[model samples]
Target: MKILSLPSSIGLASKIAKNIGCGVADYKLTRFPDNEIYTKIDTPLDGEDVVVIGNTNTDSDIMSYLFLLDAAKEQNPKRLIALMPYFGYARQHRVYNRG
Candidate 1:
């Protein structure tokens, strides 16, 4: 079975992978001087199970996650699981304190 994992940094994802004994496929993200973001999955992911782990630290994090999800779908993974530990805009659950 193939497993694809995308983590924000080397600390968390790598540690978890080692603990669980799962092969980790690293995903790279590059930003240009023009402020454009580029992302890539480093391993063959066709027909594999994908798990994306990311914590929300900036506005771009959410966009990055969405991009990864779309890419994962395109890869035709047997299953897609997005494991986001911290979500930033989650506080926008409802409208309150109307002025």
Candidate 2:
């Protein structure tokens, strides 16, 4: 099994990997000159279970999550698991801004 994560969830991923005695995949995140996000997965995931963790706290974070997931998928892992600790898009009994 392999675990990957963004900055928002790296600590949690580390705790999980430590508890389960699994390996954590190394990756890099950076921004392009035009301010676009970039992700690079540095571990092999072929035929292994892959788990990605992140929080949707902001637009960049969501983008990072998507990029990480796409990067993982390209590796052709046996299964894909996504762990979203905080899904910020959800709303309850509160009035949203004027539409």
TM-score of each: 0.77, 0.91
RMSD of 2: 1.9
Q: Report lDDT per candidate.
A: 0.70, 0.91
Superposition TM-score, candidate 2 onto the true structure: 0.91
User: 1-99 in candidate 2: lDDT tens per residue?
Assistant: 999988888899999999999999999898999999888898999999999999999888888899999999999999999999998776745677765
lDDT of 2 at 83: 91
> Model 1: how far is 68 from its true place, Å?
2.0
lDDT assessment of candidate 1: 0.70
Best by TM-score: 2
